[model samples]
Target: MDYNEDTATDAVLASFEETTDPRLRAFLRLLVPHLHDLVFEFRPTLAEWEYAIEFLTRIGQKCDDTRQEFVLLSDVLGVSMLTETINGQQEGTESTVLGPFHMVASPQRKNGESIDLLGGARPCVIDATVLSTDGKPLVDAEVDVWQCTEDGFYDVQQPGIQPPGNGRGLFRTGEGGRFWFRTVVPSHYPIPQDGPVGELLKATGRHPYRPAHVHFIAKAEGHRALTTHLFVAGSPYIDSDAVFAVRKSLLTDFTESRDEDLARQYGVTVPFVLATPRIVIEPEEGDGSG
Candidate 1:
C-alpha cells in the first residue's frame, strides 16, 4: 500500500475499514470514492481544500439552539429541497421543504384565533380543511401553522420585537375537518445572509429571498402527515425560491371580500381578505414504508 497522489483516495478510504457501524461504513465507502474523484477532477490545491474545510467548520460553528447553520448551508446548496423531492410521496399531495424557521414548538390555540400576538394591522383569515384525496373529510386532524410577520420576519428571528409565539399556532380540526385562524399576511423576505452560506450565494450571484407563505403541518390518525406551504399568489421570489420549495399546486390566493356575514363568523372586520384552502391528506399503507 504505497500511498501517493494517485493512492491518496484509497489510503483515506481504507482508514475507515475499522468502523464498526455497518451503515457508517457503507456511507463512508461510497462517499470516499466520489469525493476522491471530485478532488482529482478539480485538482484543487492544498490551500483551496483547507479553505473549503474551514468554511464548512464555520457553518457548523454558527449553529445554536435557535439557528441551524447546517440546514441553512443545505438550503443554500439546494440539497434540502432535492432530498425532499427524492423522498416525495407520488400519490399524496406535493411536499415541500420544512424551512429553518420551524425550530420551535407552536402553542395550541383555539380555532379562528389570531396568531399575531403583536396585533399589528396586517390581519387576514385562513380557512382550511383536511380532506382525503377521495374527497372525504378527515375529522380530528391537527394543523400546526407558523409564519413570518407582515414585514417579513419570523417570531424567532425577532425575539425582542415580537413576543414568543407571535406568529405561530396549532389548531385541531372541528366537525367536517375544518379549521381557521387569523394572522397577518406575511411578506416575502430574504433568508439569513450573514454566514458562509450567504457568502456562497453572493459568490454565485444568487438571491436569498423566499416567497410569502404560511407553513402547514397536518396530521391525522391513519394518514401520513403533510408538510407544505400555501404560497401567496404574485409574491416575490415565488419563481426563484432560495430553497426551491415552490410548487404550482401549493400556490393560493389571498382573496379580498366584502361579505359581512363571513367576517362576523371569523370574528374579523368586514371587507377583509380570506385565504380558503383545502389540504388533501393521503392515507398511509401498511407499515408506512417510505
Candidate 2:
C-alpha cells in the first residue's frame, strides 16, 4: 500500500465515483486530478499542507450574510474574473467579476433618477445609452448599478452610517434606449481586509485595493446579459487591479466641471463631474427582441 501523493489522490477521488449528484462527481473527478498535479508540482511539506487546510477552513468560517470570504479568496486569485471571462458571451462588452459587495437588491428607478441616497457635497451625473451592435437602440433594457461611496464604502459595508440603498440603483432604459442617474464620483478603494483573504494579501505583499469603478448587470429581453464595470479612467489601480478585472474598453472618463445650465437640465446643481458612458452591447444573433 504505497501512499504517494498521486496514489493518495486517486484513492480519495475513486471513492466519489458513486456520488449520485452529477455535479459533485464531475467536480471531484476533475479537481482530484488537478490537485494531485499541483501537489506534485509544489511538493509542499506536511506542515505546508496543514497550513493550507487551515487557511481554507478559516475562509469558510469567515462567511456570513454580509461577508463572503471565499469570494474574496477567489477574487484575489483571479479565479472570479477568469471564470467570468471564460464563460462570458463574446458578443457584448467584456464581463468582469461582480465582487462580493452586491448582496443587497437594488431598488428600481425611472430612466433619469438618482441612486445617491446620501446627499453629496460634490454633484455627479451618469448618462448612458444602451444600443445593439447593429446600430439599433435597445429599449427597456435593465441596468442594475451598484458602487461604493466617494469614500470607498458600500452601503452594506457601513449599515449604520449609510442607508440600505445608498449607492445602488436599478434603472430601466427609456423608449429611446437612454438612462441617466445622479451619483457622486466614486474613489478608488481597498477590498475588505479583516479576513483570511486580507491576511493572504498581506503575506503576499500585494495590495487589496480595486480601482474606482461602477458595476452593472445589464439585461434586455433577448440580449445576453452582461456583468461589467465602467472603470474610472486614471484611477489609482486602473493598471494594477487587485482582481484583474479592468478592461480598456470599459475605462470611462469623468470630466469635472461647473456647468450650471447642464446641471439645471439634469436636475442637479453646478460644479459636478459628468460621466457619459455608452455601453455597446452585441446581442447574440437570435437574441435581440426588436
Which number leads on TM-score? 1
For model 2 the local lDDT of residue 33 reads 83
lDDT of 1 by residue, 196-233 (tens): 88899999999989999999999998888888889999
TM-score between model 1 and native: 0.93
Model 2 pairs whose backbones collide = 222-287
Cα distance off (Å), candidate 2, residue 171: 1.0
**Global lDDT of each candidate:** 0.88, 0.87
Tell me the tens digit of each residue's lDDT in model 2 across 72-149. 989999999999989776655788999998888999888668888888888789999888767678899999999989
Q: Against the true structure, what is each candidate's TM-score? A: 0.93, 0.92
Q: What value does the lDDT take at residue 25 in candidate 2? A: 88
Q: After superposition, how far is residue 279 of candidate 2 from its true place, in Å?
A: 1.7
Q: Which residue pairs come into collision in candidate 1?
A: none
Total backbone collisions, model 1: 0
Model 2 segments more than 4 A misplaced: 1-6, 19-26, 284-290
